[model samples]
Target: MTAGETVRGLLELTRPINVIAASVLTFIGAFVAGGVTTEPFAVAAAVAATGVAVGAGNAINDYFDREIDRINQPERAIPRGAVSPRGALGFSLVLFAGAVVLALTLPVAAIAIAAINLIALVAYTEFFKGLPGLGNALVAYLVGSTFLFGAAAVGNMGPAVMLFVLAAIATLTREIIKDVEDITGDREEGLNTLPIAIGERRALQLAAGLLVVAVIASPVPYVLEYFGSVYLVVVVPADAIMLYAAIESFEDPTAGQSHLKYGMFLASLAFIVGRLAVTVPNAL
Candidate 1:
């Protein structure tokens, strides 16, 4: 392949869109952490740490899932024969090491969190992906924990837990929807995913129900007076978007899956907006 083609293949392996979205979540987590500890530098480092860690996870996942990708996403770097599995694993290890080193610059709690997450990422990519609901739950936890990881870096975890739960459920909702889209490949690969364990229509119903939970929980911070009218203004609309996506996904799983992808970004924005100007008072 030409150099340009090779570069594009590497970029595809990194899954830029997913990694960048995870980075934004990390940055927002840093913003939330900054409110608690008032450490600007730590927050910045945490964002970098999170981005690197999640990017590593994504690369490694693709490395392990190359065979699956051949069926589901043939254009992926490994499936398309653009990058070798060994090379991808090495690249992921470098990214993982960088993430751990960056986290070590923070407090002990942050370091421990990073270490645990490193192990979990390896496990998820290697083993959990084929386990029925177990793998899906792991992905959701990783997504939600990005926020908590930042909060921990600053030596505080106050109201960020609420955000973590909110994020997890929203992530779970999308993941289930995506599972519906991937059912064919997942079943063929013996992955036993939720959509395979339960019927696609049933999974779609469950995903839509979870979306309702996310929408309902979105306004809790305002209800508890943790945030003001600004949060309500943005979050309400975000919930509406998710609600719309949920309904659509129920009606048409494939199209709904696509909608949920963008809708997830909007939900993330609402999270940033909700906490953009807030002070958590030694939250429980």
Candidate 2:
């Protein structure tokens, strides 16, 4: 394949939506950390590094699970022969290294957070993927790290830290729900996900509880005066939708429709709103 083809393949494999989510979360965290100056280069570098790390994670996930993916996700790039497994592994390693280099130019805290992210991704890909619940926790940790990295970049670890902790809990809960969504396929592939190991009903109950915690925890910073009330108004509906979806999942774990996915999409909108609420003038 030509360079352009390889690049396109990599982009497709990495999934832009995840990159965008990471970028948005990072921006929110950076904005919340109020002491920071607007450093465009620093923001760009951090976002780029995050994108690289996410891409690397995707590529490595595909490489490590090529066998199971061949069975469950035949349309994926690796399974479809668009990119060889070995090539994907090489691409992942290169992107991971690049992320580290980009991170080094930022504050030491940022570099430290980025390094932890890299290590978590590697550990997840290598050891946690097959272990029930552990994979989801690792993924949740890294997911929250995007925002933490932003906080670190700006030298404000106070409010940003709180936001990411909530984010971690939320993402971990959602990850479990996602596993429930994929239980059949995962079981077929002999993967031991939470839903498969813990039984679907109990898993859904756990997911519902987690979603409740996520929604309730999200508004704490705003209530405590770390942010404005505008954020609450904007994000309340999104959080409600998430809670409702979790309730629905708990009510009917056997119903595998597109509603949960849509709920997740709407939930993501809350993050964007949180960012806008904090960044906009007079929002408080």
Candidate 3:
């Protein structure tokens, strides 16, 4: 490959979009904990660590899933031969080292969370991906832990607890739907995902049910006074979108998962708006 192609392939291996999204989530977590202003340095470190860790996780996942991608996703960097497995692995290790260095600058609790997440990221594809719901749960936890990690960085984890639970449940629902979407390839690869273990329809139904619970509890932050009333205004629409996405998965798992991601992003925006609505006014 040319140098430009090699650089592009490396970037593709990191899945930059996911890294950015995860970093945003970590920042939101710190913001919700009311620390973005008071503890700017810690928040920055947490967000950077989260982004680097997510990039590492994605690269390593791509490396391990190289074989499966040949069948399920031939366009992937490794399967298409744009990047070699060794290169991807090495790139992921460098990102992991960056994450560790950034994480070490945080508080002890954040450091501990970072340690667990790094280990989980490394072990996920090889050890957890084949197990029915375990893989999905692990991914969910890792996603949600960003909130907790950020909160811990600022020494205020209480507010982030609810955000963590909400993000985790929503992520778990999406992961289940994605498993259904990937059932064919997973089955071919002898990996028993949730959809393969249970019927696809059943798995989708379970995913919908989980999303229902998250949607119902979506207003808890507002109710607990952690957010402003504007939270309800935004979250209600976000909840509706998520519910529709869950139902849509029954007919089109691909579209369902994609729409679900959009709704989740919207919900995250609500968190920012709600926090700002409260904090900005109080500061004035």
Tens-digit lDDT track of model 2 for 1-284:
56676667677677777777787677666766753357666777887888888888888888887877776678888877778878888888998999888899889999999888888877785789768899988888888878788777877767777777777777777778777877777887778988889898788788778778777787787776666566677667767666766777665543422354455456445555555565675553
Q: Which is the leading candidate under lDDT? A: 3
- Any idea what lDDT model 3 has? 0.93
Q: Please provide, for model 1 over 1-284, each residue's C-alpha lDDT reduced to its tens digit, 9 standing for 90 to 100.
A: 66677667767766788778776776677676554347877887888888788878888998898888889989788887777888788888998999988988998877887788889898995788777678878888988888787788777777577778888898888888888888888877888888888888888788888889888888886776556557777777777777778788866777876777677777677666666556543331
Alpha-carbon deviation at 236 in model 3, angstroms: 1.0
Residue 144 of model 1 has an lDDT of 89
Clashing pairs in 2: none
Model 3 TM-score is: 0.98
TM-score of each: 0.92, 0.88, 0.98
Q: Model 3, residue 117: displacement in angstroms?
A: 0.4
Where does candidate 3 have its weakest 10-residue lDDT segment?
275-284
User: What value of lDDT does candidate 2 attain over all alpha carbons?
Assistant: 0.75
RMSD of each: 3.3, 2.8, 1.2
Name the runs in model 2 displaced over 4 angstroms.
Answer: 1-7, 250-284
